[model samples]
Target: MAITSANQLELLQTAEAVAREKMIDPELVIEAMEESLARAAKSRYGTEMDIRVSIDRKTGRATFTRIRTVVADEELENYQAELTVEQAKQYLSDPKIGDEIRDEVPPVEMGRIAAQSAKQVILQKVREAERDRQYEEFKDRAGTIINGVVKREEYGNVIVDIGRGEGILRRNEKIGRESYRNGDRIRCYIKDVRREARGPQIFLSRTAPEFMAELFKMEVPEIYDGIIEIKAVARDPGSRAKIAVVSYDGSIDPVGACVGMRGSRVQAVVNELQGEKIDIIPWNEDVPTFLVNALQPAEVSKVVLDEEAERIEVVVPDEQLSLAIGRRGQNVRLASQLTGLDIDIMTEEEESARRQKEFEERTQLFMDTLDLDEFFAQLLVAEGFTNLEEVAYVEVDELLVIDGVDEDTAAELQARARDHIDEMNRKALERAKELGVEQSLIDFEGLTPQMIEALAEDGVKTLEDFATCADWELAGGWTTVNGERVKDDGVLEKFDVSLGEAQDMVMTARIQLGWVDPAELESDEEAEDEDAVDTEEAGA
Candidate 1:
């Protein structure tokens, strides 16, 4: 192969033909050709020469040149490619370091070996361009649904020809044991698109919760038009799924719109999911109310939500326990996922028993701490006095509401409660001191004596130690590991220290220690507020 006038137009014609077949830009193919020609020119000229090639877009004519850069005498390592500025006076009027000097070179007449090498170079460039094009086309398509043809099955993974590229559907990402044959048309969620050394990998998933939501988007006009938004979705692959939706329009019911007329829209999605049962529920801002809706078909006797723990306890009728928990706890698990909360479903009988046990425990506590008889403790528990703090610090009028409790009796109860609490605090403080707690930590306001004792037990003895602690470490929190929530115990968790209060106290300690600037914090907070307002305005 040689660059001749007769074949100049042929080069461009071949480039356009290859570009059309690969669905890539013709200029990329031309660039690849120019590079291949340059390699051939390097072989024809001295292999050490700095050969370059440029092709005219209109004329398809190839031009070859050798570039020698002028450099400092000490820096000129390549004799064929570089020359010192003092040695290049004859070729240029003035020369400087980093300046390139070019000279035209005759095009190469590539032999069989060189032609094969050039062909390989062009193919490599074309393949790279193809991969880049595929990545660019599919990267933003992630989190969307794509239609493709099943090209082949490699091991347990299915490879689909998705228009310009291939996508992989891993066996675990498939719904149930769904299998596909060659030439089968498939619809899947574009989970991810990544550029790899080999090529761009397009990962598709049929079992993703978003897949179901997308199917609904396609089937439900209201969902596609954003009249109804899918708030959350939880799926057990081909078994069962739940979708929570909210409607922006007051006239529209999100659930009804998703269900469509006579269950047509939902039926379409269900059929696509291989008969997966779906429960469409309306979205609610109230977590308890939303959970009640998410549980579906089972009546909840009561919902006890622990916002701090991100947990909810649902009490159902004895008969509804199995239904609420479903087969192998699937119902409650799905409800938990849909509401982003850990759920504990129990029968009403169990709840009653648990409440009785708690009441007995509180009654015993009051009896022991206040030196009260069983009847008096029972009276205190019945009046919602669970801890000594309430009896100690609450208004006397509130304690007087209890049956057979006069003002003098209330005063006496308060006095007993206060004495017991003071004694307990003294004991806790003494224990903390014994554990080597410092006065700085004790003097830090907001921490109760019991809290300080707990911190000391946990090896946080000084204010410095407390300041270094994370808010979550002091207030306890839930951590999600491998899709399950794990509880992290905190030193002050038993003392009823909230995360916000712990954060404030920690920041206060940091400011006191000169570790943080309060003015800087205030400015940062103001900047954040301004950014939020700007975002709201832009959104509007």
Candidate 2:
């Protein structure tokens, strides 16, 4: 069928209709149509020509042209697309080397295969444009909530038709007890909007903690208006949840505002979550106070924090321990998540017993190691002396504070503590030597006697063996043990040497073995070169 003037007008009208339906620029659709027509035109005019088609937007006039570039003789890379300056003179009076020559070709009739190819091209372009538009619309909307109808279910995942686009709510991201049917109205958090090979993928989630936060934002007017801010949220999804909120204004109570008048606001959120129980706690900057609030309805007797270890030990009354821990440890677990700390909940009795046991063990250790009787050991333990290192390192005045310890006695105790440590080190060094530890390794500056013994036991018995060890093997690097990387299982962990000290020892050994002393290596190379030069001069 010949592409007449009426066909050109029909093509323009069809492009405009499809562009409106797909919500894409009409100009882009026209470009796609022109390219499709150009592809069909290639069958009439040989495919060797650089064929192109352009359609007027307003008049709907279609023009097909073959393009050729005039180039210098040496610049003609493709014979079909380029012509030498001299060869181009036949078609024109004067031709510049970089000028382009376009020849108009008459529009021809299209065969069945050619028309089908044009339709496919148009459809592909429309699909791509639709995907690009969706990506641009939703990419910045990530982390926001949107409502959509459940379009279909695929392999346990719900496909939601969020107006103008579709989103997937995977099975794991759905609430455990909640079920969705087709055409059900659902709201979800836009977890991600990704441009994939097939199209734009919008991933939705209902179980994310952010989803809970967003729901609260919707229900709580103060939260949305920035009067009250949600500090943290942790959810068990359709079971229970904890949210911490703080108010910038002292007059506004954040918890009360979020709970709404007579619990209407929070109830709205719970209804959306399929009756997920939410505990709204007031946020506190103090960690212990925050943790107490996080474990709501469970009275906490005390909270002991270990800041360095990022752990907390909570002491609840014996009657309240079960409540503090909740059913199957859910309360404590959610509290930990809310506060970003590891929580260990125990009864007051259990904590007291544990402290007593630790005290007895420390008292025994001091009595046995320092050769002190029970009275003196108990006095030291009572004064907060836990390890021998502290006893050896403390000033004489510290011991003088203990009863029955005069200046001279304190001095004697210090001497004895020092002497005991020196003796232990001497014995460890002798044993390490007996175990075949090299003299160089033993003499290394940073290697303690205990570290040397550890190395000898691990078959690192010589200076050469020590020098050949990797930094991670000696010091502690992450190593896969039972399919997980362990950081504390380094070879030096059993010894007194720290990871930094282990690394230093390895470098010192390498230097001692002359393996990597750059200054010395350069000097040696220079000396050898000078000697060779002298020898050559003498021979000449």
Highest lDDT against the true fold, candidate: 1
Candidate 2: clashing residue pairs, number: 0
Alpha-carbon RMSD, each predicted model? 2.3, 9.9
| Whole-model alpha-carbon lDDT for candidate 1 | 0.93
Model 1: worst 10 consecutive residues (lDDT sum): 489-498
The global C-alpha lDDT for each of the candidates, from Candidate 1 onward, is 0.93, 0.87
Candidate 2 off by > 4 Å: 74-79, 436-447, 455-540
* Cα TM-score of candidate 2: 0.86
Candidate 1 clashing pairs, residues 3+ apart or interchain: none
Candidate 1 lDDT, tens digit per residue, 1-540? 788999999999999999999999999999999988888888888789999999999998999989999999988799999999988888888987888889998888999999999899999999999999999999999999999999999999999999989999999999875889999999999999999999999999999999998999999988899899999999999999999999999999888888889999999999999999999999999999999999998899999999989899999999999999998989999999999899988898999999999999999998888888999899989888779998999999998888899999989989998888899899999999999999999999998899999999999999999999999999999999998999998778888889999999999999999999999999999999999999999999
Reference-based TM-score of each model: 0.93, 0.86
